[model samples]
Each structure stands twice: as C-alpha cells, then as structure tokens.
Target: MIIRNLADRNKKGADTEVVDGQQRLTTIYEFTQGGFSINDELSKRIVRDNSDSYEFDIANNAGKETEAIKFYKKFKKGQKVSLTYGTLSSLMKADFDSYNMALTYISHHDDNVIAEYFRFVQNQERLRAGEIINSIPDSLLEQYLMQVDSKSLLFKLSWEDKRKEFDKLFYAAIGIFDEKLPLGGVDSDIIEYVKNSAGIAGRALERTNLLITQLQALSKDETWNFSSGINKRFVKFLCMLCGYGYVDFSKNPKEKLQQLFVVNKKLSAFSSAKATALSNEFVGYTEEQIENYRLIALISKGSQKWDMVEERMRLLAVLMNEVKI
Candidate 1:
C-alpha cells in the first residue's frame, strides 16, 4: 500500500494533501521510487487516475509526474490524464493519521523487547538502598553506593569485550580461592574480599590505577600489544590471581600483584609440563578428545567440591601431559 502527501515548500500554513488512498499511499510511493513493482493493471490504473481526479499538484511530487507519465505512455498509449487534483492540506492530515496508526501497531507488537532493553541499560547504573545511584561517590548515600558499585564488577566484567577470557580468569580464581578458604557465609569480609579482589574498591582501585599508569608508560603499539589476544588473558589472569587466588606475598599491598605474576608463571610451567603428556594419550584421538578437554577445563579449577575439583584437574593435567607420547 502507498500514500502520497502534497505540501507547499513555504511553511506558511497547512497546505498539505493526501494525493492517494491513505492505505496504499506508502506502497505507491515505494513503487514510484522503484523500490517495488506494480504488477496489477487495476492498481496501476487507480494510481494513475486518482491524482488527476483529485487535482493534487503540490511540490514534493514523490516522482509522481515522471511515474504517471511513464505509466500513461506504457499502458494508456498517451491518453490525456483524467484524474482530479485535491487541496494538499486535507490529504496531509489523513496521511499523518495513517502513519501514526501504523507506528502504534508496530510499537504494540515490540513493547516487550523494547522494555527489556531499557531495563538492561538502566541496570548498568549502580543502585543503593532503594535509590538509583550515579557513578560519582559521596552524593547522598556514599557508603551504600560504594558497596553496590563494588559488587557490580561481575556485571561489568560479563559485558567486557574480552568476556570469555575474563570468565576463565574469574572461574579459575574462584575455584582456587574456594578450595583454600571455602566461602561459608556472606559476611562483610567476604563482601570486602570480592570487592577488593575484583578491583571494585579499596586496594583494587589502587592496583588498577597503577596498571593504567604502566599502560600509559608504553608506546601505542606496545599498549595495543598488551590489550590484544592472549595478552588480555594474561592480564585478567593476573588480576584474578592477585585479587582472589592463593598466592602469599608479604603484607605489602604493592607486592601483592607481583605475587600474581609469579603464580601465572607457575601456571605456565604447569601447562608446559602437561603439553607433552597430552600428545601421547591422544595419539589417535579424534576431535572428541579436544572437545572433552574444553569441558574438563571448566571444572578443573572452579567452585566444585575439593574432591571433584582435584579429580577434574588431575584428569586434565594427565591428558595434557600425555598428548605428545
């Protein structure tokens, strides 16, 4: 369907008209613009005859003159146009109403999806004590705002561009920490631990600030190198290990992150040691072994019970170690 509106170029008054039927005006407009083809002769006749019948000739022709001329030449064999033209003003009001109705129908159908997206965007803001919180601290309820903001690292990390790598780091950190400390209850310490480790509060912010400084120290290419690919994995792993995992450096806050690099070195060593073992056991192994490796990796260092985590880790370690032989 198509509708065409005729309007005066000067914004003097309501000099607008609907040159064609409101239901079909858009379709006719599209057809005129070559977006669609009018295959039916009767529809073509209606379009050609309606313009002259209404005497509708305002500017913004919508290709009507050229289209009408083409249709007449092709179909009517150059017959004189026989439609009446109407005032552009009345046609415009009908066109506006029809367009609004179409939009209303579409919005009704998409209301749920629109609402969900809106909620997701709103949730990005931190909340505190039944109030929406802004990004800045110390506005009204500072302490509660800070607490909520600290806990929101998980959400932020989930949406990171390098999400999968962050997920692996998070799972691994939680796995290691849970094995050692065993989160028994939701206490202030647990909350503080999560906030501190995730770099959402206190020492975490300092650490992040330092990391950013170091990044700024490097050249653009070097900075890009650190941010890309497996480097991101390394960085996230370092953060997780230092923040939550089991690695005891001295009480010096500055050295805590250094300890994480040491743990990553250990993990690298472990991975290297297992690389040969993984090759031999899967000598004629199909892709299924590789698939199993990924599944096994998930449970290898997660919040599983000690026995389950150890078993999975042992199995993966063995598989990886025997791959070469």
Candidate 2:
C-alpha cells in the first residue's frame, strides 16, 4: 500500500512510492478477496473492523498514522507482527557500499530478478545523482539501462537453465568494459573521454549482440544441446577479453564472431577431470588456483558437471596474459 504525505504532495499527487513487496501486497489483496486457499486465522483477520474508532491522517503529525501501522491494522489477526518501513527516496540516496552489500546478501536468498532490480535502481540513482566516481560515462550507462528497460531482442535469447542468463550477459559486459574506462581524473574529463571513446563501447556491444544472436539461433536448433556452464563461461570469457583491451576496437563483428565460434567449439570438449588436473598442476599457486576453482564452484550445482568452467577460465587467464604459459 502506498501513502502520500499531504504536506509533501504536489499538484500531481504523492511523493512516496513503494519500491519493493509489490507482489506480496497483490497476494494479500487477492487472499482478502477470498480468491486463494486461506486458514481461519486469515479469514477472521481480513474482515473490516467497525468497532475501532481510529482515523488515518497523512498531513497532521498529531494523529498521523504510519503507513505500516495502517497497513498492519487491516490484517491484525491477533498475532505478533512486525513491519519494517523505508522510504524510496531515502533508499535512492543510500550509500553505495550499503546498497551493494544489501544486494549481495539479497542475492543469496531472493530470486535473481530482485537483485537485478536493486542493481538497476542503484546504477540509475548513481547516474541521476551525478556519482560518476568510476570510468563508465553517464551516456553509455544510460544506453545499457535503456536496453534493460526495453527488453530488446538481445535479451530474449534463451539458455539451457532457468537462471537469468540474459541479465548476466549485460552485467558481465558492464563489469568488463567499465574497468577499461580511464579513471583517476576529474569526473568531467573522464566523462568527456568516455563520450568520445565510442569505439571501445561499440566493440563490446558488437561482441555481446553477436553472442546473443548466436545463442538464440543455437537454442532454436533442436539438435544442439550445449550445457549451461559452457554458455556462462563463454560469456564471462568474452567480458574478460573486452575488459582487458584484448579486442581491437576497430575489428569487425564478423571477425570477432568467428573467433567466438572457435572458442565455443573448443570449450564444448571441456570436462571436470581436465579441470581437476589443471587445478592440481597449479597446486603451489594456492590463491590463483583457489580463485579458478571458485569460478567453477559457482556453476557446480544441479546434476550437470560445471567444474570444467575452471579450465575454461584458466584458458582465459592465459589468453589475457595473466599466466606466462
């Protein structure tokens, strides 16, 4: 439920909006409407209470009711209840670290979309507030945001798993390319550089769009059955390439697509045993090997084997000149 502070209202209306828990509110409304299976506790609680002599006032501080309190009163089913309240405007201005940590924790328990939603809000807020601390320019970031909001064809590509693979694609692209931005300079100067550095962003977008197209076609081909792990590793590797400045900014998309196809075909043959052997070879390099294994561990869940993702990652490390051999 949304509440508007009378003092804070403009000609259009309320200044506050609920940023989360929208679906829960819908479910509760439907339950109150007797549309879903409910226990006697819920049925008794949802009924309107006429005996109570309470009134809600938005403007007056003397008798004003909090939004949570007003919302909870309707469902006061004679049980202990607690509701947390947060304003959307305050959250938009929250410290970046706090917001990032919250999303990180939320990602562990909540669905992917929830975390993605926070990410979208955080980045959009940063752009709006002129927090260009990093290299990514406002214009480039806005373009990517537009793509996410629009749900263009590139984002519609499917994969073997149920995870938000398309979201991962965009995040990976931003993560990799953003690192290449010129930093440690004035914000205005950096923004100027980014605005003129269209070639870099263009190359990254070309690879990303081409990969999405290829994935879409491959998904439609009934005979092809690539594993989810391979697809993810492939995308991450592409980001590594773009992030590390390995891709020639002027190179045509066709050439990069051919290179990606070759790499994808090679990665198809990767196996867990090979990844294990690769890990064993770098046993003395504990930190490096552990990081490699960590990437593999991310996709190791479910019935499929994804430990081989480490091997592919190791290959990327070498290609990016992080490893001597």
- Which ten contiguous residues of candidate 1 have the minimum total lDDT? 100-109
RMSD of each: 24.9, 19.8
Candidate 1 per-residue lDDT over residues 136-255, each given as its tens digit: 112221222233222233332233454433433433334233443221211222333443442244543443333333322221211122222234334444433233322222233224
Candidate with top lDDT is: 2
Report the alpha-carbon TM-score of model 2 versus the true structure: 0.26
Q: Candidate 1: global Cα-lDDT?
A: 0.34
Instruction: List candidate 2 segments past 4 Å from native.
Output: 1-143, 147-163, 176-230, 273-325
User: What is each predicted model's overall lDDT from 0 to 1?
Assistant: 0.34, 0.37
Question: Residue-wise lDDT of candidate 2 within 1-325, one digit each (tens)?
Answer: 2121233545678543344556765775564454565354543332223111122122223755655335445445465432222211111112111221111111112235444545665676634322212234345444443433223223322342323344444443443344442211222333344455444446556644544444344334344333323455455455444444445323443345345544444333222223243334444666554444333333322112222433444444443333331
lDDT of 1 at 140: 21
Model 2's alpha-carbon lDDT is 0.37
Model 1, stretches more than 4 Å misplaced? 1-160, 163-175, 178-283, 286-303
